[model samples]
Target: MIRADIDPKVGGHFLVIDRRPTGDAVHYGVFLELRRPRRMVFCFSAAEHDHNADRIQIDIEPLAEGTRLTLSHEMCSEWGQFEEQTRQGWVHVMQGLERELDAMQVVSVPEIVAQVAGEPSKASAP
Candidate 1:
């Protein structure tokens, strides 16, 4: 669930509520610090273990050929052990993004370019 301004500004806020995959609990947060078209930061939490909530930041950059996406998670040392698991999750998300883009005829991902041993699809790049 999200409730916010139709056009978000720097001080705008949004609430996100989602059910955990296991359906054992709910996760939610208020995301603010918006920088239009470039960055946004949010905190993610599951009700039972609020201490583990992390500040998640997403940055988007326009490249010469396509767009670059970077994700960062800020958490305490207690969550350090889950780093690799977090990375794998991001990988899955990116692959899903690639497929969604494909369906929309959007840009190809870096992984696909590597697979072809060549440049990305022209239509998909720009």
Candidate 2:
């Protein structure tokens, strides 16, 4: 993401601008609920298709080994055609998050760009 302006409290707003090969994708949202380290609910919408905003809920659970994160995104029927892409996007985001948490180091945008551009990611290494 090129820019991420977020306020993490309930009712707060957020704007994230991601650099994509096609162009910058803008996503904006409002936090509906927030329970620190446990659960979060938000309204998410893209700049290109804001008519039908989606609701996303994330639940984080404690595990002996690590954390288990469960994310549920309720997309508008209009977005059904892009389900696979949306799923993949979430997978990439979660993988990035896991990497950052595991390494305890920040991952640069350039590295993410390269990964999205088809460079092999460390997760896929032998």
Candidate 3:
């Protein structure tokens, strides 16, 4: 999953690509609409798998400077007994995402600019 666009006020959109356990890309779709730092709704349909699978909705809320994220997946009827496995998969993915965001926060723009400016420019050194 990758953020394609973000409005900050209205919402954001993401481009999601799914790969099977066999290392083959099986699904590609977009998260249509999302409210910035709040809610997101997305649908996935694999060309090689279930074409009519239900959509997934994710909601996020700010909690004491951090964020609380919730995920609701529709169309569990298709998975039968594997529904629990799917839920567990989402939990792992969510944890990974949280860690990624936390790491990103450590790199500020000003620090990046300072680091870049400290490097020797090709044009000239002033």
Task: Please give the CA lDDT of all the candidate structures.
Answer: 0.55, 0.72, 0.49
Candidate 3 deviant stretches above 4 angstroms: 1-21, 30-32, 48-51, 106-126
Quote model 1's TM-score: 0.61
How high is each candidate's TM-score?
0.61, 0.79, 0.58
lDDT of 1 by residue, 59-85 (tens): 877776777777776654555666666
Give the runs in model 2 whose Cα sits over 4 Å from its true position: 48-51, 105-126
Q: Kindly indicate the candidate among 1 and 2 with the higher TM-score.
A: 2
Model 3 agreement with the true structure over 1-126: per-residue lDDT tens digits: 422233322223333454557654444345566676666676554442444555666776555545556666664354445555656666667667656666788622221100111211122111
RMSD of each: 10.6, 10.3, 17.5
lDDT of 1: 0.55
* Best-first order by lDDT: 2, 1, 3
- Regions of model 1 farther than 4 Å from truth: 1-25, 48-52, 106-126
